[model samples]
Target: MAYSLVAEIWSELAFGMLVFALRFFTRWKYSGFRGMSYDDLFAVFAVTFWILETVSLYTCSAYGNNINLSVESALAVPDSEVPRLILGSKLAYCAWIFYILGIWTLKGVLLCLYNRLTMGLQQQRFVWVMMVVSVLTFLASLLWHILSCYPTYRAWQIKPYPGESCTQRKWNYVIICVLDVVTDIGMMAIPIPMLLRASLTVRRKVSLVLLFGSGIFVMICAVLRAYYSLVLIDDNTVALGWAAREFLVAAIVVNAPSIKPIFSDFKKRLTENYASGSWKSGTGSNAMSSGLPPYNGKNDIENNTAITSGNHKRTQAYKMSSIGRSQPKSESQDHINTATDADNDSTNSNIGKDGIIVTTEFKVSRR
Candidate 1:
């Protein structure tokens, strides 16, 4: 009894935590991208499943310390009191319907994520086909649950004779289990080929797809649940207990993988923030200035000094050259013309006026 209670508490806590974590991760990873239709729906389905599982667990007293016989014994007082217990049991069955729907919706969300990540029109079409098939299976499962026992209340309340009650159809359980296994397998298999073609490094691609493939654990849980479900047909006390245990275990296992992506995104964000903060604090403004070559420490001082000195020298030279070029051009031109005329007259005096005459040209000769 104590073990049962503990398992019950653990299951509740685990499912709640899984739901929170899955939402955290989904928001962290996909929230930045706009128009994420399926992710939100996935979160809703997760929350719904968690709620149904909690209600079912309580209604069935699956987590409680009392055994089935004890419950029956406690409620053996009067016919009037039996209805309440019976009602509670019926509510438990209804919760199961929700639980099954929750699982089916989760499968849809997973496939949608796969579809978003996968490339190619063909693969996308395949995912859509799977989605349609899964929805149909969910509907079929729901129909079976609703119609399994004619006057379904008989599935809960005991009849006059031990064997006379209209119970759930055996084929319904079989079909539900089969549909579950097929969907689980389909969900697990659909993402592999697309993941293999991802441009990420081989290691990263493998790791990511494997992380997604962790949903197969759900399939494993489903298989175990299905096996124990067979035991439920006998309605033996031990078999019922085992079946409940298996159901809780499978439910927890399947939801457990959803937490990984959430925690992964949290870790990544923390890492990026830490690196950015460290760079900001350590480098300061110097880093920015250093990025420009002209502002580098040694070169900046040298260049500044050279620029000041060169400017001063160029200013002095410009003043001196301006003053020198300020002379009167007309006076300079007249002086040059007078010197040229004197040189011509001297040359004509040395040579006679006529053709043969420079005969008496004064030539100073030193003895």
Candidate 2:
């Protein structure tokens, strides 16, 4: 058995699964219906296919991989183990298909994310076109692989029957591998045009591009896999390692951006909680001396809408010499004015007592 194949699958999935979990958690934190969006749906699809690939790989391991035996020698293996070997071959076929599915779904996931980030109608149209083309190419590649050998089972069968010979052409797969690279490049380029026009600072735009940079590495993997696809056509046993790496790399690329918000959220909460904890309890020298009000167990929040407009008369009633005080016309006037004055006074008083949040703005009057 080739232990290296299993090890490859193990390493890639470990990192992929960690980011997958983070993506799910961040989506849930931001929205209740995480799976409702197309992006999340694609994530679910990719994850399902990846899990199936792992199962298929484990089943393939039951038989000896890279046994290094001649056809005669392989056929000579004990009848009991021959079935295991054939079974493993079939599992490899299934795992290969799962790898394709996982990569395709991830491409969709990336496109959907880019679609959300872009603003122009025309840009969105281009994204939709790319998405459609990507799906078509994947389907074409899948069809080619499945139907490459007549009766499909021959695609993974150990040998030809007494009369019927199975197709074992490696060149047929080269097309798929080449198209894989092209589509990956296409997916990577779809958002660059819009990203270049973003109003954000250079640092943010660079980070955004770097977020999509994983695709470039994935393209490199596809090139390697292309070479291995030929190797696979010559002999299928040599491909488990290559396919494993391709699947993992594509996985990490699609998932890399979705997990960043989780890190930022964690950092923000930790800093705010630490700062709040630093404020000591009590009034006067204990708390007010530091300019931070003492925190009462019950801290009621004041919303922005409750703030008095700049037009509201100042709470302190100072009678100017030019405007002598006049008597109120009625009890109602006195009642309303007095209540208004009282509320405004209370807000100013709470500046020191409940000054938990402060918002400032600058304005230049047209007059």
Candidate 3:
């Protein structure tokens, strides 16, 4: 009993955190943008699922009475008495309605994303068909859930003289399980073709799709829940525990909504770097040159003339100016230009290596 209560509390807390985190991440991702789209649908699903799971937690008496009932006692309670044993069992049924709604909304969003990703019209149409089929399957699940028990309240409540006998059908559960598996596979497969077309390295594209596809882990949890469902057929003790576990796992699975912002930030940084031109090959040299202004031509001539007249300070100044001009644009370039220019400038201050220094002459061309 203690273990069960602990598990229940942990599950509820985990589910609540996942919902909050998904909302936070979605808002963070789209904080700079306006309006809504399919991504926000996932956020809605997360919140909806959180609410439903909270209802289930309450209805299951996860926090309240009968908390000390042994596993055997829990199992012994008949379905008729289970509602009284629990707190919000009736409300839980209503919650499942919303859970089903969230599932349908999620499927629609996944299909829309697939459609946006697929390039060809034919592929897009195929995605639409699959989406429609998934929706119909989900609707069928909803119908089964609603009618699973004739007098649905009998699912939780017990009366002195039960009017109509309403029992759970194994086939109904099986149908829901089948629908889950099919849609899980369909959603997982939808991104493959588009991931293949992404303008990235093969490794990068594969990594991205696999990362996005990690939500398929939820399907694995669903499969496990289906297995537990078989055990739950006649055993409320086992069923309640397994259901709680599955709810927790589902909460974790829906957390894909939170990852969007991380991916968005990465893309944003890449865009900024690309736009700054800092990624160009020769830009580094210009960046370094801009930090230090070059010496003027007049100063170069005066120093060179003083150097040729054997003044050591003037010679040093002339050498420095020559060094600045001959310093190649990059570390890869040779310093031979510096040595030759310095030697010639020292020998004849009147003529520089590149051109003759004409201090008093100007040429004007008219064309």
Candidate 4:
């Protein structure tokens, strides 16, 4: 059982680190470390605490081998084994502290994202309010962890069989679970109004909503973690496993918006390669023989009257406007819309007549 728990912890650590690395790489590719936003800094801190938590969990489960040890059961352990159990209990406490730190730091990241997305909009005020609430709740959660068991040393008491509050810390789980869910819901709320008001097709709007609304999965994980933590009070391994899963989900949710650049890069390369292949196959010559423009890079841009690239692209059919701004213009209007792409790079617009379509990106400037 201990070996299995160790394997699970290692797996979580590997995947969590991978997600963080990809997130940072994409961000750095577009904006160097100096260009990183508050959310990116928050992610750094979150990942740091997560690494600490992972180390603590691994040590407690693998070296201590102290799963399913109730307070009463712990009192009967051999003298030599007692020290191991005590150490495990202390490590478990440290792991929860690290977990709390990582979780709240992620909340800060989400709030930073919301603040940036809602800049120059009425929703900005709501974000400020949520920020205040999040700070207070985080303090409350941290204080609960520090003061819940009382005289903290009892948390590691094995001989006297300290109360369940000290051994299991049930109230801490409940408090953190409730507060975490509330903050996640608040984060999800920030993007909805902007998405609804934007002049986007239903399909695009739904996709954006689903992307931002991924927090629902994290909330579900929180609830299950709390449920099993209380239900299986003797098995710290189960609770730790659930907490790791919850953190993994939250990390993905926090980074999903920023990782769009890598995908956009892949799509651009694929389109360029496909067009290049067509020209090399003499398809261009055949099209010219039939008095039709061949499918080549130059013709592709000329036909659409738009330049597409990994960093920036211009589209005639769709125009993504800034938040807190007017809807996209009609085909008759000569208005130009400059969209901030996944790489945070802007492009010059070209004149074209097409139906209105809108998308969104996070920009720091207010207009």
The TM-score leader among the candidates is 4
15-82 in candidate 2: lDDT tens per residue? 77887887777666544352236888899999899989877876776564322334555455666665
Report how far off residue 39 is in candidate 2 (Å): 1.1
TM-score per candidate: 0.59, 0.67, 0.57, 0.74
- Model 1: clashing residue pairs? 25-262, 352-357
Worst 10 residues of 4 by lDDT: 282-291
Q: Write the per-residue lDDT of candidate 3 for residues 1-367, one digit (tens) a residue.
A: 3556445745665665766565555544443233344655665675666566556655555423243344455566677756565454455455456656665565665565555444233467678778788878888899887777657655444333222223324454467768877877777766566556543466856765775586577677666666775656554444445545555555554444344545555786687566643322211110011112234422122222222222222222222212323211111110112123345445444433332221122233322
Separately for all candidates shown, the number of backbone clashes (residues 3 or more apart, or on different chains) is 2, 0, 0, 0
Q: Which whole-number lDDT from 0 to 100 does residue 314 have in model 1?
A: 17
Q: What is the C-alpha lDDT profile of model 4 across 1-367, one tens digit per residue?
A: 3347777767887898898898888767655565477888899999999999998887777656334556567667888887777788788889988998999999888788777666656778999998998898888888898898889888887777777778767888899999889987887788776676555567967877798788899999999999998898677778888888898988988787777657766776687676633221111100001111222321111212233333465544221112122221111111111222421121113312231223323223211
* Residue 336 of model 1, lDDT score: 10
RMSD of each: 31.0, 16.2, 19.7, 11.7
Native-referenced Cα lDDT, model 3: 0.50
Q: In order, what lDDT does every prediction score?
A: 0.49, 0.59, 0.50, 0.69
The sequence of per-residue lDDT tens digits that candidate 1 reaches over residues 144-202 is: 77776656655565433222223334465568778888877777666566556543456
Lowest-sum lDDT 10-residue window in model 2: 329-338
TM-score leaderboard ranking: 4, 2, 1, 3
Clashes in model 3: which pairs?
A: none
Q: Which stretches of model 4 miss by more than 4 angstroms?
A: 1-3, 63-72, 276-367
